[model samples]
Target: MMNHSMSAATNVMKTVIYIVCIFFAVLSIFPFWIMFMNATRGTFEIQQNSIAFFPSTHLISNFKILTGKSFNPLVGFMNSMLISSGATFCAVYFSSLTAFALVAYSWKMRQPFFTFIMAVLMIPAQVSGIGFYQFMYRIGWTNSLWPLILPAIASPAVVFFMRQYLLATLSLDVVNSARIDGSGEFATFNRIILPIMKPAMATQAIFSFVFSWNELFRPLILLTDNEKYTMPIMVSLLRGDIYKTEYGSVYLGLSLTVLPLFIIYFLLSKYIIEGVALGSIKE
Candidate 1:
């Protein structure tokens, strides 16, 4: 009788947990559903009923309006793709290299260098925005994508995350073994360490990509030419004024802006799960 009651209580608890999970899942998906639905609706309809769940037949119309304005979806997509991809590559590769150096090499200044990186990470980007922009301007890099892409190499946050990941996952024995086998530092890093760090790299790649994709302030400040405008800037431009803002077109543009992020997340989501699982395991 006690066993049966315990079983029943366990079942009840699981059911409650499942219910809670489903509820939160729906809550998380609700905003994306509304945004996509609103992209298909007319501005008047959206303004009238903002919480609409049903999709409308005005998708083409919204697209037409978006294109009729200064927004070029294709150009914006290509530019954002280029910038974000470049930034992600620089951030992940360099950060991983830096972390590997900190972990694999025994140097006098290693801890101090890491502490400096942590110090930089604690400093917000906005704090140095003015100085960074001035430096870029002085270098004649303003209105260019170089400033946006190249600076990602020195990403303190990525460095910190990679260092922590390396600390947890990396084994110096492996490094020494590679050395004993006559593997060059770069060769071991590229061939062995990189493969071992794949899950963590993918996780950070997704984050860095999404961050660069959604970035606006830096691009807006550094770039003046419309040809260099990113997706976020294009979306911002869609809002002409309070009175003339086309809600449908703006939503459509926003939906387009967010599509790549969803694609990237889905592609790298498995790595995130793997990273979490790997981190949980004990030697």
Candidate 2:
């Protein structure tokens, strides 16, 4: 009788947990569903009723209105893709390399250097924006994507995360073994360490990509040409005037802008779970 009561209690607990999960899941997805539904409805319909439960037939019309504006979704998409991909690659690869150095070597200034990086991390990016913009302006890189892409190499946050991940997972015995086997440092890192760090790298890559894609401040301040504007910039521009704003078109642009983020998140989500789980375990 005790065992039966315990089993019943466990089953009831699981059912309650499942119900809570489903409720939160619906809450999470509700906004995106409304946004897509609004994207399909007419502007007047959206103004009349913002919370749309069903899709309408105004998708093509909304696209037409969105395209009538100065912004080109295709161009914005391409520019964002280029910047985000370059930034993600540089951030992940260089951060991983820096983390490897910090973990695998016994340099004298290792702790101090790591401390300096932590200091830099504490200093917010907005604090350095003016100095950064001035330097970029002096070098004539303000209008170019180079300013956005190259700065990612020194991402203190990514470096910090990678360092912690390496400390949790890296083994110095493996490094010594590779060194004894006549493997060059670069070769060992590229061939052995990178594969081991794949889960962490993928997780960080997703974050970096999403950050770059959604970035608006630097691009808005630096990019003078509409041709170089990212998706966020274009989407922001879609709201020209509050009174004349086409709600349907704006929602459509937002839905389009967010599509790639969803794709990136889905592609790398598995690695995120693995990276978090592995980072939590200490061997």
Tens digits of per-residue lDDT for model 1, 13-77: 99999999999999999999989999999988988889888899999999998888788889899
Candidate 2 TM-score, true structure as reference: 0.85
Per-residue lDDT for 4 in model 2? 100
Local accuracy of candidate 2 as per-residue lDDT tens digits, 1-283? 9999999999999999999999999999999999889999998898888998999999999999888877589989988999999999999999999999899999999999998997888676678788888988999987799888988999888888898888889989999999999999999999999999987887888778888998888888888788898998887787678426688888888899899877766777787677567545534
lDDT of 1 at 142: 90
How high is the CA lDDT of each candidate model?
0.87, 0.87
Backbone clashes for every candidate come to 0, 0
**Candidate with the greatest TM-score versus the true structure:** 2
Q: Please report, as a residue range, the 10-residue window in candidate 2 with the lowest summed lDDT.
A: 274-283
